[model samples]
Target: MELEYDTRYPSVDDLRERARRRIPRFAFEYLDGGCNEDVNLHRNTADIRDVELIPQYLAEHRGSDMRTKLFGHTYSAPFGIAPVGLQGLMWPKSPEILARAAFKHNVPFVLSTVSTASIETISEITEGQAWFQLYHPAEESVRDDIIRRAEAAGCPVLVILCDVPTFGYRPRDIRNGLAMPPKMSVQNILQICGKPNWAIHTLLHGQPNFETLRPYMPAGLNLKQLGAFMNKTFSGRLNEERIKPIRDMWPGKLVLKGVASEADADRAIRLGLDGIIVSNHGGRQLDAGQSAIKPLASIAESFGDQITVMMDSGLRSGPDIARTMACGAKFTFMGRAFMYGTAALGNRGGDHTIAILKLQLQQVMEQICCERTEDFPAFLVRSEITGSAGSTMSNR
Candidate 1:
């Protein structure tokens, strides 16, 4: 909430080379490709930058806060904004400019049910504190009218995803035809006429559809009949009889986003779920798996106290969210680092990528005198080059 960004793009690889020179190489390779041959997306950020953090130079210090909390709500930080599916084709209104920068930085901003804004316009731009993934609908009355429009848009949390189940052999989204009713080709309209400010802000924000499945589509279906109505209306696999009826019809916070295993974090804690993100989809669904920090360190060391074990694939910074919260991930999410900061600073890319990840995680919690954010697991670094046991390192 104290933003002034554009310090020459202070990293996320300089906002991914200024969002690959301001979009349109098939929308920056569909927000930077990942399936097959990406090899678990470059080993999910090279195994989370091979986790390392240790800095108690004469311990005893209390000077870093970064709030956090989760599930019961506190979040000034602990990473968020990991739901990306055609976010205004990468920039135009980029999901209401990252749901108004995740409601002016309180945090959390999930939103993608094939997003392009909707669900009462990002719950009135995060007034309802955005969070709602759910790509399930093979029709249970369109998944109970999208969980009654995310409980009448006061959505607290509801994720759901469960890895793409299929559709990730992404050869740059199949040579940029970008699947599902998306073959605009003529060399993709000459690479969108060479990105004239991303083709004039996608012609004043018009073509990015799927606005929460436009009340179950079918109005003027072109583009291969809207990709055959999104492959005959969704269903990407999730068991326990489709998650015990969305855990008995969603009451509130219930995550479960593509968990990588510990037997699906013991089946999202025997189908009752409250959390479990350990994603693989960021590797764009499989591509010979492994590297979501090796199934988030054995599913946060075997179900991190049974659930709430959050994570996302290859996080990009803030010390890779403090090495995935010192390797246990109580919370973390990052769909292409705030979409490479709104495709490189259009509408100040979500408060300049959440203020350069809260000033590089408060300078690594004040150079590891580590005062909070759960004491970053006492600055981990336990030896034999991080073979677990609370690992961290950086005193070179």
Candidate 2:
């Protein structure tokens, strides 16, 4: 379909800047900052940008088509909205807005387990087209119940997270009262007061809560209690033992997200996973980890035939999407970019961001004379960068 987006904000950087100005400082930092020094955070995008695609203008090309097939569904684009927790905190009703847009755009929207909207709500919004991501719950009963809820909601895919065995030490979140034993401070209140637009919408929507986990949480729990509850509830660690039961129970396409190594890719295949998302939790968990694209190149080359290889974490633009695909990522997803859009433009943010990404990708595909999304790898200009350990990443 022909796309029309806001000309004022043409890129994600523009949306991010606007989002920063529009939302409170703490919320923006939570969405924007990475763990520790953010070394991996900046490296994610930088390494991807270093990847060059060879344009073949002389080749015969009818047109470019971005339609991509994955897990028995053909999507309009190769990219989807990666799961983001507490989306409502970033922008009220942001998850639902993005879910509606994803459904309309014929792309997947993976709802985070901790997102503001419940599975049933998002499923209703998308007409059972949305996917659900599973965070590791402590009890088998809770895990099974949540999986059952996802199945009942008509979730086509169950993406289980593997990267966050423990919470990353984000100094920004700790200072902003987003960490364990969270306490709202006067400084945070003043920042919120400064952004009247954000404050008004937040007030209108009510405070963001873990809507999906509300059943398990006690009523009227304070901020500190809420943090304690979360800590006690989710173990945040996934091993072969934990995954076996979920794999047996879930009757949908099973995906393992936060894969950053070839051994883990092999493990996913051995465990009968339908796919693996080559990610580093968007550089949120480990500051010392390698950029997702670096491992993606090896993982895709090694296990692409055995299991689907998709990627997230560091893709910010259409060209970035093209770069990852050229590096062997079967499909791509973006988290902060979509959140930035919703926080910046309110309801129209979802549609506008999707439109701009689609248009941007179309331009790249046509310029490279690539007719289909699957043809992206043929246009890749392989370059190598050696790591500190002497291993090389072809993605560079």
Candidate 3:
């Protein structure tokens, strides 16, 4: 049976559902859950929904342009694929699939430090369109070695994740017995068996080994022991002293992800970071944290001139991308949403996710009478958010 692309998974929710059905329970929960109570996860999406857009009418909105310039390159859309760890676990060869898709669509696909594939693999797959996100191991030598690998792989940008001071206490993971380097269990085996397609894909590919970690990992360890090794090896906390070597060594645009406060934004600027993602690790780290969009306007206002202030966390669609742009983010990235697409459709996931977001953004641009990407910030109304409604203001 031939599947129609348009009708199969129209929305992110639909893709998420399909992904849930196709992937194992433990893997799905790990991707979906946030820290502790998951208050911040709910808040991230809710807050984005709460802030409504005031559509402008009676303006010649012909030929809306979604093109955006960031880090000295023009992107088809303002959004890019965010770095998600253990992508192969979500779906077999997910990093390669996503990187190829992003390359075809002419957008960025970030590779996580803990991802199954290494920068070199992604570099080949993505044709250097893949950006590397470093978790910054506790040891300086380890960090330096990783940075050298990224540079050698032709990674144009280095994204240092700054907010993972410690691993979040996700109850979902605890309940599912899920963490990095997943262990095999009867329940997990049953779940895998239920999705024979996924199981076959994984088996044919030989268990989705972490090709990136082959150099460091010990021999003869199963997935469970690998998990323990990773948990013990990498330090969750990242600081300035740790960042100095990376900033000094990497010859590319440096970004500090997981910046949620003005203090952190200020620090990013001081450290000479090329950009900063005003994210709370997609609300995965702090359950009570505010939505990534909420602090963006203020942060952009304070430091947009000094540094690039991009954002991520709760962006669901193109309109959501527009809304975040209206708030303040120079560019946006989506992690779970794209992963949902990849997990939902396997080989076809990346293209479908990009297609959906591009169409959605085009619709928002047309409705809002926004002709260009830069013009969106100008139409954003700051006062309507405060109350009386219909009050429009220029960019703050």
Candidate 4:
């Protein structure tokens, strides 16, 4: 893929700043804020940055390739667009934009159960190649139907969330009325008036709703009723009992997102999961929990042999993706980064964000003398390595 992006916004940080200016205050905070204190949110990126890579200028290196194989697909890069809820709130038709970009790039795009786009729509856009992440519904019937829909849509991977036993306590969202029982206050309306571009786009797309859940939801429910229906419908926590049935019936790659401990990783292996994504729900849940990178090193070292170990949360750029893979993640994903891209540049956002990341990562590989995405661990600084690869580096 050609490395082309709006040079005005060359970096993810630039996209984030532009997005902050473009989107409404309430929506931006919903996409950007974390749980109480946001300690873990900040900690996650801080820890990942602490990892350093060593370049070998003298080593013989042909060229760097970012292609990686996971579950049965060899994606264009080691990263994919992560699943994010309420995507349309941040930018109109964001799920579709990202899905199309990802498909064109030959990378994975995961659709969230609560995202604005429905399974069938995204499936049609991606030609049924996108993955689907489910929010464990309280009703067994609802869960079964959603799973069936995903299967019928030809989603290759089914990601079930294990975190978010309860929604995080986000002060900004609460103050902005983005918390449960979502509302459109006069203040929000005034803010929407300020961003005419976002306002017009949202109007054209129609107000965002749980489109995937439309078939199941009762007709004619307002915001308050929608919030109530969401709270009453999802269970949010996963145990063996909840997962065993899904594993039995999915008949495709089953992944557990939000894994943060070695014990949990081991449990996932025993439960016959195909992969585990080490995440803290993007620090949107468990502000007090350890940063995702910390558990990622331990879990990947201990259990990488048994199952596919991937990660998300706190990753922002291509260098961050390299750092995460060097630390032992087989694959990486990001949610806010792509959203920021869309919010900043509208329709061009998804393609631009992917382009930026690919170019950045390719540069890192060339600089480090690494030849392949899987070879990143070999370039990890000795002091920074924390896994079995680190323990056995003397042999290399």
The model with the greatest TM-score is 4
RMSD of 4: 1.4
What's the candidate order when arranged by decreasing lDDT? 4, 2, 3, 1
Q: Please give, for residues 1-396, the per-residue lDDT of candidate 1 as tens digits.
A: 565778888888899888988888888888888877888888889878877877777856758887889889998889888889988887888878888987898889898888888889889988898989988878899988898899899998888887876667788877888876678889988877888888897888778887988988979988898888898899888777888888898889888888777887897898888888888878877778788876676677777887788888888889888878887787888988888888888888988998888899889888877767866865777533235755333331
TM-score of 3: 0.94
Model with the higher lDDT, candidate 2 or 3: 2
What TM-score would every model get versus the actual structure? 0.35, 0.97, 0.94, 0.98
- Stretches off by above 4 angstroms in model 3 are 1-5, 180-182, 383-396
Against the true structure, candidate 4 has what lDDT? Answer: 0.92
Residues 294-345, model 3: lDDT tens digits = 7877888889899998989988888888878877788999999999998999
Q: What is the clash tally of candidate 3?
A: 0
lDDT of each candidate versus the true structure: 0.82, 0.92, 0.83, 0.92
Error of 3 at 374 (Å): 1.6
Please provide, for model 4 over 1-396, each residue's C-alpha lDDT reduced to its tens digit, 9 standing for 90 to 100. Answer: 576799999999999999999989999999999999989989989988988887778777788889999999999999999999999999999999999999999999999999999999999999999999999999999999999999999999999999988899999999999998998899999999999999999999899988999999999998899899999999998899999999999999999999999999999999999999999999998988988988888898789899999999999999999999998999999999999999999999999999999999999999988888988787776443354343333333
At residue 47, candidate 4 shows an lDDT of 87
lDDT of 1 at 10: 88
TM-score for candidate 4, please give it: 0.98
Each prediction's total of clashing residue pairs, residues at least 3 apart in sequence or on different chains, is 6, 0, 0, 0
Ranking by TM-score: 4, 2, 3, 1
TM-score of 1: 0.35
Clashing pairs in 2: none
lDDT of 2 by residue, 11-121 (tens): 999999999999999999999999999999999999999888787777778989999999999999999999998899899999999999999999999999999999999
